[model samples]
Target chain A: MNIPMPDFMPALPEMFLLGMTCVILLLDLFLTERSRVVTYLLAQSTLLGALLLTIMLYDNSRTLTFSDTFVLDPMGSVLKGAIYIATFFVFLYSKGYLRARNMFKGEFYILGLFGVLGMNVLVSAHSLITVYLGLELLSLSMYAMVALQRDSVVASEAAMKYFVLGAMASAMLLYGMSMLYGMTGSLDLTHINQVTAAVGSGQQVVLAFALVFIIVGVAFKLGAVPFHMWLPDVYHGAPTAVTLYLSTAPKLAAFAMMMRLLVDGLGGLHAEWQGILVLLAVASLALGNLVAIAQSNIKRMLAYSAISHIGFLLLGVLSGTAAGYAASMFYAITYVVMTLGGFGMVVLMSRAGFEADRIEDFKGLNERSPWFAFMMLILMFSMTGVPPLLGFWAKLAVIEALLGAGGLTWLAVVAVIFSVVGAFYYLRVVKTMYFDKADAGAAAIESTLELRVMLSANGLAVLALGIYPGTLMALCATALSH
Target chain B: MSFEQILFYVFSAITVLAAGMVITVRNPVHAAMFLVLTFFSSAALWMLLEAEFLAIVLVLVYVGAVMVLFLFVVMMLDLNTTLLREGFARYLPLGILVAVLIAVIMGLAVGQNHFGLAQVAAPAPHAASYSNTQQLGELLYTTYVYPFEIAAVILLVAIVAAIALTLRRRPNTKHQRVDQQVATRREDRVRLVSMTAEERK
Candidate 1:
């Protein structure tokens, strides 16, 4: 009853971005086709302004606002900054593609901004209700974005599938949450943690059931195995630009959701949840790696690759240690960087009539453009977890975390074996680019200079980070420690 | 049994029967009507539990708005009931398995033994003058105002998404462009006659 008026400063970035998104939505309506640039510029500046505000409002100590529904802390600030940077690059890459297809409109930018806002709220959520609302907003925006190219029946079908499955998963999550609420008498994560820590094993049956449903929901969101039927279809069916955006930043939000519900909220149930996560991780690793080798479509292959990467991400969180959490964060950030580049290349080579989504499309890419091919090589190698690449270090961090868990040595071994299997498909992409003969009159790269520069930077940055992982690893450690 | 207990049993039985009919009815409109009945009976049952606000809201929202929308869509679509029922037999085994599993789980967690009157004392009824709605409103607006605002934003998003998805510019339909009309210039509409009149081919 005596909760003071909560300080609004912790929420300024979200508020600022929300207001600017609305202003741009209105401002775009009045602008002519020739002046569509204004809308794009406004959207870009909104992200920049939000990033600036996030840094300005950054606090070393954790702050809870909105009556303890929202949290602003080092982890949230870091993740928000990553989302902004990733979205900034995604928007820049999407422009030329949209313009070429006559799909350049304000809706894409507006929906993307809303999606970012959803991710922002999700990463900082301190309550079950906040997490649910944030997840819905993000999922809705993504569904709309997937169906943005209205003339494509494939896109529409994919959107329908994604929406239906996503809704069902969310309902399961809510059902589990209701059970937890009944048990704990609170929806606040901190309060739930406190209540759960004191509960006896007599409630184990109900708790185990709740954990299963919650894990199912989280696995579905992360595109882990058995719950990942929608991923390949949605990824392959959406516009490559939308796919690029969807695959990159949303992973961070899902990671935050897992951290909140599993770590912050229900740490007392770690034994049960961790067992479920291990099963999901192994299943995802096996199915993802094995199925990816058979896929001829590049998007579907990457979708499977994403599934396998999620398995690695889970290895860290399943460890249930601070070191593991920090490693998982590092893996998520690096995965986003690598995915942006890999999908960016797919977007770059695609033109008005060409989708450039087949494995053979990259044949002899080196002969066409050696520099771009090398950039892709860096991305592919990093994804394969080859030594001296960013992905290698990401995997190593999680493996070490698992080893430190002491009892999960078998899981660590399984992860390493699957990573080796995963390497084959990634290497095949590189082989297709360098050794295979070029098709007659293969389309030339006609992307804008901005996209080209950004894509190259995105790819090379993985290499740069691989060489200097110390700073970023330490940053993750610091963020998770607080 | 007392009159209140007898009424409770009657309403709950009706609610269960209607809910069963909602899935089993052959006609789509009939199914929707059964759903409305189910909602009404459930609302009555909530009233028995002294949750007047929940009862009224359930009736007003579910029976009034949501069921009407469902009926509208069901009527608008020309669905073939025989074709819809074609896969029912094929999937019956799987469906039954799932149903049985869910029943067992629910039984273990919230069956009569866990939720019976013996386990939970009945809440004392409030005076007739007391208002459940006012208490609900006070808590919603004060303690849960953040979620209320978030719900508003979600509704706004639904509106924007609906319009964005369905609204389209049809090329077959012709409409005047106000921008072109307003930006009209003399040269754009009609050229000067100084040297153009004699140049007809």
Candidate 2:
């Protein structure tokens, strides 16, 4: 199947990202450590630049480039835009944290730009091999990032676990792809879909197994239950800046991969995969929320909370409709905002030589800094799905999609129950901040101008979105319109 | 019965043997080395399948770059073989059980009558033009373009995530900023004076 390259420019966002990354790398080399602010500004500007390019390229028309392996469409554009914006904020949030840690290096900005580039590719990939390439690129960089704090045993251990588990998932994904290739004689997802659509019900059993193996890879990436053992440890062990980036950006990209592969590539096999996803959704909700209540470390708690949100996102996938896809995308976007704010608070509360990761670290936060505490209150409430918060709208969209899908009443109920359980933990953070007494020895919250500005925006955005979610929802719907 | 089949059997045996040694080798460094051997043989098998690009990449990236890093880390760590082996006896029965279960399931799943062991297809007369590498390249760059671009973006995000995780500031450490060092010139600290000795006095 020879596809003539479209006359349209190939990979506009990719070209922009590569060009920006090089410029950032070269420019950072000349910036003094005292002027590390320049690197931060350059990195943020690069992400913003990429985001603008993505928005400008958001046409509904689909074009295949590099001959057919790369695609440009509204869906990919919106996802790329979200990833770039999320990355921009992560860069902003990390600046002060990195500066305080004495490990501020140009490699951080250069590598971050590359990582964002990889995610853009993963979200737009339409072939199995391309998917693997994107996944491996993302995984390899993450492994190195997790181990960046070489002096910390916890970080090293987290990296090791991540590497081993990630490798196993990659192998499973590869084996599944090979099997699919052997059966269909093609690596193109469209071809695979056609082949599977023609197969008999009995033969579909083999396809089902292949799908299970593929979902194992997806489950690992999403940190869904039964494959989520690594999330809490990695989240707790990584430095706050990395944790902020990890919790926000990867979730969105992983959802993009899922939508491309499971929804678009294998939509015909929805019956088989939906069953598996329902089970996973229920399990993730139960395990993630239930386990989180016991965590003393705020990062670990949020990690579990992330797992449960994956469950909510999976509900949208189980719906198996365009609306469901839109809802899932919205859920991912909202979750990114919530996570950034959640981790942004962690960054603000932390000081040099001390990581403020424990739930206890926030005790008396309201008394020590009322404004920051109020900001955290809004974020926590948003995460808990309280009405009039962005998180609430995100949850409402998914639940409505699930209800509309029908035949999933039990799963919907489980989702609600888990939301309650998850809320308990988020609320616990609020209680620690407002109800409890402040610790006399608690570290003073860092008052870097950038941190303050970003944190305020990150937290306020949740409220703003919650109140006027129509715009985000409209964009999501447009992207998933197909 | 043909030479291709003979070569397949040879590489298959080497792959399995090296893979077994990867687990059995007591030293972590040796185990990693054996794993590298396993990867090389696997890549050779991929070449036999006519996937030249994948074969070379598997060898170069996984076997070369990845495994070299693995070896470097394994050698640097102070590993205790005895401590690692202490739980082997306790876990051996469970491991064996799981392994056997996997073997049985795989045997049933891919039995000759199930998945069917069809003979490999004969290569087309124009094998040179229909080379796996060329075909794959054409397909990836053409029909699968969106996915290819998306993959690149994911990789970029991963790079960013890595940098963010490792970059930190420590109050106790003193580090030179590149810009500051570059700003210094020969004339800034070392002034050329007509009578340097008299000036010093």
- Pairs of colliding residues, candidate 1: none
lDDT of 2 by residue, A155-184 (tens): 889889999999999998887777677667
**Top-scoring candidate (lDDT):** 1
User: What TM-score, computed on C-alpha atoms, does each candidate reach?
Assistant: 0.93, 0.86
Query: What DockQ score does model 1 reach against the true complex?
Result: 0.35
Q: Write the per-residue lDDT of candidate 2 for residues B1-201, one digit (tens) a residue.
A: 989889999999999998999989888988998898899889989888788889999999998799989988888998889988998999999999999986776665455634665523555444576666777888667766555555655555555555556556578898878997899898888977685355544
Could you tell me the lDDT of residue B48 within candidate 1?
93
TM-score of chain B of 1: 0.80
* Model 2 chain B poorest ten-residue lDDT run: B117-126
User: Model 1, A6-95: lDDT tens per residue?
Assistant: 577998998898899889988988999889989999999999999999989877899997878999999999999999999999999999
**Second chain alone, TM-score for each candidate:** 0.80, 0.80
Which stretches of model 1 miss by more than 4 angstroms? A1-4, B1-8, B112-124, B174-201
The most accurate candidate by TM-score is 1
